[model samples]
Target: MSNLTIVLIILVIYMALMVLIGLQGRKHSSNMQDFLTAGKQGTLLLVTGSYMGSHIGNGIVVGGAEYGATYGIGGMWYGVGAAISFYLFAIFMARVVYRNNYVTLSDLLEQRYGDKMTSIAVALLNAVSNIAVMAGQIMAGERLFQYIGLNPLAGAIATTTIVIIYSSLSGLWGVMMTDVIQVTVIVISVIATMIFIATQGGFSIMAQNLPATSFEMIPFDGETFIMMLGPTALFGLVSSTGFQRTVSCKKEKTAILAPVLGASLILLFVPLPVMIGMYGKALWPDAASGTIIFQVLFEAMPPLLAGLLIASICAAVMSTSDGILVTVTANIVSDIYHKHINPDADEKSLGRLSRISSVVIGIFALIIALQFSSLISLLSLSYTLITAGGLVMIVGAIFWKKATRQGALASFIAGVACVVINKMGVSLPYASVFPLIPSFLAYVIVSLMTQNKNAAAA
Candidate 1:
């Protein structure tokens, strides 16, 4: 059979398996709570698998490889940053969020900030950012398909349809169960590919063929560190998806431990993609960075193995797309629709709304994916907005007792404004850092003013 034929068969089989998993998961997801959090019954294994599955999406796989091609071993910083974020989530945010019985990140904001507006703002921000994240996954899947002789648009539609089906069917249960399967495939495929590389001449050959600058752990310039590393590390602390995983755990300790464990495992897999990218750099230095992973997989592995690896790539993309689709739907239904549109929305109505919202948001994400081609750039922009606008408020709400509603709102506005200004061709010292200063200042100043006024009024 032709390589394309083999890949197409494998793809069909993999997708069918996902449908079966989704059908099985549907049994457990009968209400809003089940749809959103899998009834919060996730064991450590389930939580860890799902968390790792969602976080290490197409962005990490393709982006990490691209960075590896450009920056050599140092490209592992992206994964390292992600790992650190999960650790921070485990240590600081997990137990507190669990103890408070918060269903969503916005729930914490609503309870602490005492404002419907703040919750709505956060819901909207998270919805936009997560859709961008989902778009990155779709873009990656599209690229994977294009590399294998399929039309990119058709590929994106097919990928998006599969994600919507599984996600809309069983919600978090489907997402988590499929995650378990996806992560296993990801781990095995990466390891096999890495071992293949080792048998065929190894890192010394790759290192000899690449530039020394690619291997630098940290750039010589401090500004590079601030620009490249800072925002990514901080993004972990405030990721809505990460927060969702924490809240989904059945036990507080499990919530805390799962991410840390997951992070460690993810750290181990980071090197595999980086090595593949370096190999791509060694072989096809002029090829587009986004296509390097596909080139490496197809060139290095046999037809069947390459097909399996490609399926794993689809797994990575689908796992994250489904998770984000559900998250965006939850924000719409729980945070906005339930809170404002119909406060008395019953469980059945909410459940139906959640599924419908998934399809709507999935279509929007597919549109965005088609519009944007660069996965890393889209992800970076989304991460910046989420970190700048959401992080301070989340931190203050959890740790700072005096953090006022006015303060949180001010911080969010200031942060978003700074990011917008920077994006609109205004040069800043560091795009991520410049916005944070005003955001922090706004929070502190507004909180103190509001607190003192309340005291005087009393």
Candidate 2:
């Protein structure tokens, strides 16, 4: 069969499986909670699948490939950062938040901050950030199609439509189950590629073929190196849309186990891109770095194998896209609709709203993706906002009892203000310099000051 035919067949099979899973999940999804949280019955394996699968999107594949081409195998720093964040999640934040049994992170934010306005602000921030992240995934998928001689816009629409249909119909249960299958295929494809490259030349030949700087882990100059490494490592721990993973878990154990194992697998899988990047640099150094992985696969493999690699990228994009869609809908349904619009709404009504919200947000995101020229710019801006605001409040709620409502509110405001300023091209030493440190410090200071009042009163 032709490579394009093979690719079509693989996608058809993948979509068929997704639809089947969505249908089956419908049996268990009787209420908003069931639809959005799998009735809180997620196992450790499912949790791991959902967390890792949703995270391993076009960002890692496209951006990591680009980094690998420029920075050599040391580009594994992305996964390294993610793995450390997962470890942090397990020991510190995972169980604490999940055990509280909150349906959304905004739930906790509202509870701790005692400010309805602050909670609503967070929900809006999360929704906007999610759209930006989804846009990046669509952009990457478009680039993938361009590699295979298809129109990029058509590719984005096709991928986005498939994801929205499944997620909007079946919600988190559908997304999680499909994620298991998608992540497994991705793991298999990446591991097999890594093994092939290693067998072909091992590391020595690749090192000789590439620039010396590419092989060095610490090749970047001092200031720029710190700028890159610090954010990459801690970003996951601080500002991730982690509520989806936590809420889907059957219990706290699933939450902790999934992130740990999922992160470990991510680290193990990094060699795939690094190897592909090195091989592509050796053969097609002049190609756009983002296109290196696809070019290398087509050059070094048979048509069938190349199709399989394309399928893996498809799996990664779909898995991540569905998770973001579900989470964004969850926040809208659980945090806003039920809380503000109709506090007495029935389960059936809320479930219907959840489905509708998913479709609406997914379509909106698809529109943005089609219109935007710079995917990375959108992704970075989203992360900067989240890390500045949501990350501090969410993390503080888990670890600090003294973290009062006022404190979280102030810190959240600080983080958000910094992000806006940075977006406007104004540099602030603390806020725009990087999100984590200022946000972290602001949360601590505000929390402590608020606590002092209680102490004085007592």
Q: Write the per-residue lDDT of candidate 1 for residues 1-458, one digit (tens) a residue.
A: 87767877897898788878888877777777777777777889998888778757575678888878877887777677777778788888888877876777788899987788888998999899889889889887788778877798998898888888778877787788888888888778878888888888868778788888877787446655565557667877777777677777878889888988988998888777888888888988897777798898777677787778788778768878888988898799988999889999898888788778888898999999998766666776787888889889989898899888889999999999998998788987778667888999999999998997756765
| Stretches of model 1 off by over 4 angstroms after superposition | 219-224, 455-458
- TM-scores of the candidates are 0.95, 0.90
Q: How big is the positional error of residue 250 in model 2, measured in Å on the Cα after superposition? A: 2.8
Cα lDDT computed for each candidate against the true fold: 0.81, 0.71
As a whole number from 0 to 100, the lDDT of residue 119 in candidate 1 is 89
What pairs collide in candidate 1? Answer: none
Q: Itemize residue pairs with steric clashes in candidate 2.
A: 113-405
TM-score for model 2? 0.90
Q: Per-residue CA lDDT of candidate 2, range 95-191, in tens?
A: 7678776666678777776678778878888888887788778777787788888898888888788777777667677777877877777677766
